[model samples]
Target: MADRATMERIWEAHTAGEFVAQDVEATMDDDPIVVHVPTAMGGSGYDGVKDFYARWFIGRNPDDFTVRSISRTVGDDSLVDEMIVSFTHDIEVPWVLPGLAPTGQQVRIPVIAVVDFRGPRVRSERIYWDQTAVLARRRSC
Candidate 1:
């Protein structure tokens, strides 16, 4: 089972925008880790996962971005986190909306993440959100 402390640290790093390859390496198992995101924005394996973070997530800089936790459920080897993610769309984020330019709109969306762990390290993470809500907000902007 994964250690709650380690998982918390990983989540904290991600929210703080301080997550890096080293963090991934430290918190995740050496084996390939599966990552799933909305709209097929995900990858498997260590390198693939790293590339996804570099290109889609960590690379982009949003204005006033924040992720606040609403609730959490922990199990023997799994953890589920319900969160509110808010950010201003002042920069291009192709992963979230492909071929769409920045609309300079503020968005608040609920997100859920299911994390699976192997021992003290993470094995996989699946994240879900309402893409339609984000798109609608962008359209209105």
Candidate 2:
């Protein structure tokens, strides 16, 4: 089981978009860490995870990106967070919507992330969201 403080720190960093490579290296086990996002946009292992973050996450420049937690649960070796993520689509995000150009719209979507921990380190993170809601919001804007 991982400590609550450590989990809080990790979540805080992620919400703030401050979770960098060093944070991943320090919080994840030496073994491969699996990351799964919406629309089959993620990968397994440290290198694969790093690449996804670099290309899909860190590389983008969304205006006013923020995550607001709706609920959180902690288990023996896992944590689940339900959140509302909001951002303005002022720049292209290929990972979120491949080949789709920016629509200059704002979107707010509910998201859930299930994180499994190996002792004090993270083992995997599976994130879920509705793609249709995102697309609908974009079109409505």
Candidate 3:
């Protein structure tokens, strides 16, 4: 059973700076799925997730990127999180910015994530953020 601490540990592992694909895999179920809703950048299943993490998400964050949790709701086998993700766009972040080049501008986006677990490991995650807000911020910057 996944408790609040278990879910927090999973979240920490996912966002940790020096983690490899296998490190992430250890925190997930056999057939996990992840979706970054605005960009459709995440992957499904084992191989696909490994590839996505290795190529896009893991170690892809900019030097100043950070995630600040606004609120978190935990259940027996699920967790819901509200956060503000901020970064200076100084490098390619395909998972967040997709095909856009680095704008060298500061950006902050509010994000919400729904995570489901199975047998103390994550089964899936659906992450949401305001795309229009990001575009407007980038346009003004």
User: Estimated TM-score per prediction?
Assistant: 0.84, 0.83, 0.89
lDDT of 2 at 10: 61
Candidate 2 C-alpha error for residue 11, in Å: 3.0
Q: What's the candidate order when arranged by decreasing lDDT?
A: 3, 1, 2
lDDT of 2 at 121: 72
Best by lDDT: 3
Clashing pairs in 1: none
Model 3 per-residue lDDT tens digits across residues 1-141: 767897788877765532334358767778989889998888899888778888888888887877889999888888899999899999988887877789999889899999898867789989999887787777677
16-130, model 1: which lDDT tens digit per residue? Answer: 5422332455565565454546678766888887777677767565758777899998877778999987878888876677678878888788989887877776677788888
Residue-level lDDT for 49 in candidate 1: 76
**lDDT of every model, 2 decimals:** 0.71, 0.70, 0.82
Off by over 4 Å in 2: 14-23
lDDT for residue 67 in candidate 3, whole number 0-100? 82
Cα error of candidate 3 at position 6, Å:
2.4
| Candidate 2 Cα deviation (angstroms), residue 85 | 0.7
